[model samples]
Target: MRRFLASALFLSSALPVLAAESKGGFPPFNASTFAGQLFWLALTFGTLYLLMSRVALPRVGAILADREAKIESSLAQASKAQAAAEVEAQGLEQALAKAKANAQAIAQEARSKSAREIDAKRSAVEKELAAKMIAAEASINETKTKAMANVEDIARDAVSAIIEQLSGKAPTAAAVTKAINAARGE
Candidate 1:
């Protein structure tokens, strides 16, 4: 249907030129044919204008509208994707912070546990040293008692020798004992 109308418009525009071809050197420049040429030009221009306005231009406008809508939809989708990525980034940051906090807490717990262990070991060592000191003191006291017993006999022998040296005779054991007891306030 559109092909037939286009052909009819074409034929109508071509008719006068076919009729005037034999007589003219240039029909467009001729004074008598100028009115006919102008009339046909108006007819052809009006027909083309009506066809473009009614049919072709509307199709082109619809295509442009669809292209604009698609561009807007793509922009909206890209924005949504970007927002989702930002949210994920925030979540990852939060997770990293939580992990750091957890790591610090664990390290602190380990330090405290090590300190407690060290304290316990130090206390055990201190207790062992205290016990050793007490044993040493007891042993020293036993040795002092034995040395004191030997001192009495050593004093008796010295007195006998001194008397023997002065009088050319040894002192009797009983006399030495009595003298030593008197000197000692026993």
Candidate 2:
């Protein structure tokens, strides 16, 4: 605070000297001071240019180059990952197709095997039924032959009884046999 007050007192005391020396509307527009102003402006501008070129610009350029290198590396990694993913997807598709084909083949083989089994069973059943039918026919023919043989005896006894009842006498067996044979068209 004391320093500030001393500086302010000095400036106030110098202000009158500055005002008496200056007949300025603006000092920069005064032709008489132009050469000195031009000299200071050139010196300051050259100094700023040198500082930017030697220090600040190179640092900014290095930072930009690093950022660009990181971006390029990231892009390259992304492309490699994408390519690997595509290759894996293609491999999966091929595997899936192979699996589907195998499944179809298995199903077809099973169907044919089942059909063959069914046909075998059907043939066995048909053969059994045919044998049973043959046996049944043979039995019926045997029963019919026995019944035919007994019919002759039954006719002979009936004829003998009728003759005895009509004429009070029985017919001989040979005569009855001849008559039965004649009636039967044998």
Separately for all candidates shown, the number of backbone clashes (residues 3 or more apart, or on different chains) is 0, 0
Clashes of 2: 0
What local distance difference test score does each model get?
Answer: 0.93, 0.91
**Runs of candidate 2 exceeding 4 Å displacement:** 1-62
Model 2, span 99-137: residue lDDT tens: 999999999999999999999999999999999999999
Model 2 lDDT, full chain set: 0.91
Total clashes for model 1: 0
Best by lDDT: 1
Model 1 misplaced regions, further than 4 Å: 1-54, 164-177
